[model samples]
Target: MKIVKEALAGTLESSDLMVRVAPSPEGALDVVINSEVMRQFGAQIEKVVRETLERLSVTEGLIVIEDKGALDCAIRARVQTAILRAVENPVLEWSALS
Candidate 1:
């Protein structure tokens, strides 16, 4: 339930989000979010990303996303990016784009 280095480095607004990418027993991801977006968006962010992940066929691990005002699209992108980045790759050498 920790994001580690998943976000765009400094782009992470708050530490409210927690993303986990463990291997799924169903050979797919299981995404779950502790969302409070309803107060902000008048809707639940979980259904948003859950549907998106299912539509995108992201079936792997129990992704527990803690939300704090991140939009649906942003949530999806961040989660997907985190998962992809978690996969095989060399050490990502990044510099400030600011």
Candidate 2:
């Protein structure tokens, strides 16, 4: 899924995470994450984000995640929502997402 425009999901509230996705002309996946538990769970969070992107077939974009102690499932949901919003297309392959 190509990010055609900027999109955001989630909030800054506790136990939630905010994700921002945007298009990138550079043809690379650029991810920036800010989390309170970066020291211990940063790598794991990055891995989750990468895997989510791969699952959605998102190869090139800029992703910024602001985590407020969110679990892995929440992070994945927010990322998926943000990507869907970024694409702005109603005809999504829902089966592929499963």
Candidate 3:
């Protein structure tokens, strides 16, 4: 799915993460992550983001994540939510993505 516009999901609260996705005309996946645990779990976080995008069949977009110690599942959910919101479709069955 292609991102049509900028969209955001999640919050800044503890144990949560905020994800922002936007369309990229360059046709490249660009991800930027900010987290305190970058020294240890950064690669894992990036991996999850990339995998989620691939699962959604998204090839070009700018994904920005502000992580507040969120778990892997939470990151996936937030990214998915952002992608859905960016697409602006109303009939998508979100549970089916799992």
Backbone clash count, each prediction separately: 4, 0, 0
Q: Ranking under lDDT, best-scoring first?
A: 2, 3, 1
Best by TM-score: 2
With a 3 Å backbone cut-off (N, CA, C), the pairs that clash in candidate 2 are none
- Name the weakest run of 10 consecutive residues (lDDT summed) in model 2: 88-97
lDDT of each: 0.52, 0.92, 0.89
* Candidate 1 vs 3: which has more TM-score: 3
Which is better, 1 or 2, measured by TM-score? 2
- Tell me which of candidates 1 and 2 scores higher on lDDT: 2
Off by over 4 Å in 1: 1-18, 25-29, 38-43, 89-98
lDDT per residue (tens digit) for residues 1-98 in model 1: 22223332113355334455555555555666565555665355777666655544455565666666676566666666555554555243222100
What candidate 3 gets wrong by more than 4 Å, as runs, is 88-96
Question: Pairs clashing in candidate 1?
Answer: 28-59, 28-60, 29-59, 29-60
Q: Which of the two candidates, 1 or 3, achieves a greater lDDT against the reference? A: 3
lDDT (Cα, tens digit) per residue for candidate 2, span 1-98: 88999999999999999999999989999999999999999999999999999989899999999999999999989999999999857356776565
